[model samples]
Target: MKRVLITVFAAFIALTAAAQSPIVQAHLEPSHGILVGQPIRMVVTVYVPNYFTGSPDFPEFEIENAIVVLPQDRPANSNTQIDGVRYAGITETYVIYPQQAGDFHLPREQVTVPFALAPPKSTIAQVPLPALAFHADVPAAARDLDYFLPTTALTMQQKWSSPMKNLRVGDTIERTVTVTATKMQSMLIPPLSLDAPSGIRVYPEEPVIHDQKTDRGDFVYGRRTQTAKYVIQKEGDYTLPSIELKWWNLSSHRLVTATLPAVHFIAAANTNYVTELPPESEPAPIAPIRHRSLWKQYRSRILITSLCCIAVALLLAMIWYWLPRARRRLQAWQERRRHSEATYFHNLQRACTQNNAAESYVWLLKWIAVADPGVSLQQALKRADNPLLTSDTNDLGESLFAQRIQDYSWNGKRFAALLRQQRKDHRMHLSKHQYLNDLNPK
Candidate 1:
């Protein structure tokens, strides 16, 4: 009987041990690590606290906020079963690429988690995880006698389109350039200037910094683009020389430069058509002399000349009365047509960029109706080109809309992000049309 009691006691102890066999731990390396951009990483371990049981999946975590005085790009990466604990040990990495060369730190910040415990208890507090320290490196400036020489390996790219690719004299051409990089400082990039061809006028588009990202806690990548316009004043094939862009590449620790291929364009001649009589087939036969007196000939010629003068004067008077009225009518019709299409296109462009899947569907239908006047939303959805639009009736109008709870509206963050991207892209396109408009209050 005593032996049986001992076995029961040992069994209870074994069960309890199974319940709390593992624990959770966290860490990162070289806390004072130097990264040109923001770099983040995590270490995970499972600790059962000597009495807790049955580790479930790892708990999720996030940094509440991060601040860096130095320029850096920040992004997050995570992987699990790493540094493994049978129940859990996970690591996450965050990287930031700094734009300026200087020292920066990730101050003590809060880390938050709302997770399912193994048996799912509510609000069991563990000691707060300590914040790790990180340092960011910044860009270095070059002091050179010839500034044209780039000091870094940063590179540039260009893209262009002309609304009027083929133009007559007095027509305009639009050109654009897009620059992308992973480790460039703006100060390292040289200012742009164009040496436009004779008879060509160049108007620059505003340059915009589009989007940026950091990778592996050390490198930064970003896109910058711009547009320009030119008017051709003469008829001929014209060529523009290759454009050179200079930048400094910190990674390579040297001057780097790239040149775009040269460009060629043509203008057409303006031709005029005039109506005239063909040469006579044969010389007029000599007219037999009329036996008329000189006074009769003079009288006939005078009468004919007076009639011609009177007819010409009547024609001039009619044109003076009707020309201005015709010109005004034509101008009014043109302005009205322009306004109608302009408003719709601008609105439609906005909707596409916004990605309000439902609103976009409605706007797209409206645009189709403006074009064909027969496409209903349902029918249009079938033919729409954008993949964001879905055909599933369950999703109805919600495919590309961000996932949300009982959403009657799109997700706020998603909509806001989509809108911001659109606004930036729209501005970039607009900037392609230089000196177009600046909405600055000042």
Candidate 2:
């Protein structure tokens, strides 16, 4: 009886195995054709004759990578199907692009599936299909032309980092500007450029940028960073017109213009440019001096004595009010002086940090300028002889600026600060007669 039961179980297993091995095939739905540069869809169907319905899960099917060539820019979608009893009907489709004109082949993959549970470990399966060759011929005219020659892009950006809205005489301000681009060039170059202001200074870097192309489009990456400084020795509110840049777009094949918003700032002057209002017109003329009587002089003396007290009170009041104001002004001036000294050293440090032969040599010019305001920058750089500063630089400066220079590289910041610092520090020079006059307070 046990043998008979085992035989029955074996027959059931055989039946299940036969049911799972379904016959499969693939075929394209459309018999017509597809163009080379256009989009086309093809349906692949597999017929499963002995589809299993025993509430059993089957092995999943998948295509190999790279083996299945997806044409340039072609999108593909796929699925599977089964038939008979509990059959799964799935249809696989492919979006194909034939990049080049050629004959191609589509071959079937070998698929393996396990079936038995406790007896025979598993069964090997072969996906039955043959390779089919297809032709992809492009127009002879397109073979010689390049597809990526022209491109176009549009980008916009804004920034606001400028200092004082109201710039006064003896005050210097800097503006931080940012420029965005569509199809831009080297970001290493200075992005922000100004029409050199007579009393203002502008500093910037050359542009350096790079980008790579992706599926959607070419991605652009670059940055232009610079400092545009302004020194206004005059006073007034001014409006700078909108900044605009024009460039040719390759994709659109046209010229494009980008305009920035307008800029507004105020300017003010120091004591030298200011004055108080005067009466409409002066009295016609003054009469000649007159002599005072003795009685009048006695009355004048009494009045003078009272007037002297009032005058003293007024003078004291004026001093009381002005002393605080004077202190604050003096403090502010000292702070500015300290900042100036700090900056002189900072700039020299920056120049030294740059190891590039050309940049270091060029910054050496700025270094000399910071050290000696009256010395021509070109002349000083031309005479640079530290080997770090090129020997040719000296000749370049002389040939360029027509000035004699002492060849040297500034290795210290104190000298740079003292370039102009000495001018103010020694202004208190006292002459023999002036010191005597100060003591007398005449």
Candidate 3:
């Protein structure tokens, strides 16, 4: 009996040990060095002895003065043998940007990995990954620049929509500056300042910034565009100030400036457009007449005026009483029309007849949204359970890919009729429910 008890205890210990066995490993690559405001890539690799049937839960980080940017690209999966140990792995890459200069430490991450413990015995194991740590410091050369823009290359150019020559009062001059920086982020680009002489109205537009990427999934360049519009309100010779943007030259190992020369032009008033004022004239003198005879002649006029005022007052009272009622009726009619599937169908048909694919697509989505409020177009079609409507919706979706408008026609009057029938059925169902509720009083 003692020997049997020892065997059972050993078996239990073996099971617990197997359950806690290491199945995955976590690693931070290039883990030690980064510059402040520079982005670093983090890769997490998972390894399973057998096969992984489910994804592991990856927790996000909320560290101080640091942010993690997830790539739009999917995680990479691979199978490899290291030292004759076969393993399946998945690697997830994330970019981390440190805001302040210091040592940043990330806490250990825990992931629940689901895998086949054995044949027909699948289970999940909670695994704790190793912590991530890195040091960030300011660049040595960029310390004195006061402004830093790290990039491989930088170029700036000035553009004008119209000629600045022969400027006139009330005429507008539009100037645009475009800057492109290779191997840099667009958000780091600074704003441009415009200085104009007095009597010139400067209206600066919102600056545009975009990051252009290469085909190999790497950032190629960062572009920033600044536009300002100047309106000449006073006619005079004006000098538009020069613009200078300073940036750190990563390639040259020094600071550089992109300069725009000052522009000078004269603005003359347009004499052809003029305003005329009316001439003043003396008022005619009033002649004295017989007051008694004038009063007698105007007595009937006074009575008629009183009657007309009374009639107007009655009409106003009637309108005041009926106007709100009419408004409510009109609003109810509009609401009903707006929510009706028939209305959307008709609008879609009209758009299709006009050969407007974009408008028709909008109306189709609207009708689907109305039919299934929270469901997407595809889900709504699936829920419809009608092959005809589903086929028509698919065709419509395919038509969007057509290059020319003539190639895409809805040709789905039957689908529209089906929608109308469904709407009618829904209304009937609601009315039935209402009737039952009225009879039961519950």
On residues 336-438, what C-alpha lDDT tens digit does candidate 1 reach at each position? 6754544544565565455544444334333444543443444444443334333232242344222333545344334434434544565676686654455
lDDT measured at residue 157 in model 3 versus the true structure, 0 to 100: 91
Which runs of model 2 end up more than 4 angstroms from their true locations?
A: 1-151, 156-158, 162-164, 183-192, 205-221, 237-241, 250-252, 271-442
Clashes of 1: 42
158-183 per-residue lDDT for model 2 (tens digits):
45455655556656565554544433
lDDT of 3 by residue, 1-442 (tens): 9999999999999976564443555555556656655657777767654444344556666678876665432445555564454455556666676766799887776767654455234456787767668898666766775556766678889888788788788787898998888866677777778879998989999999998865434456789999999988788989988988777665565667788889989999977533233466798897887557765889899989999999999999999999999999999999899768678767867766665544565576566556565445555656567787777666665555332335544665554566566667767888999999999995
Better of 1 and 2 by TM-score: 1
TM-score of each: 0.36, 0.25, 0.53
Which order, best to worst by TM-score? 3, 1, 2
Best by TM-score: 3
TM-score for candidate 1:
0.36
Question: Which stretch of 10 consecutive residues in model 2 shows the poorest summed lDDT?
Answer: 50-59
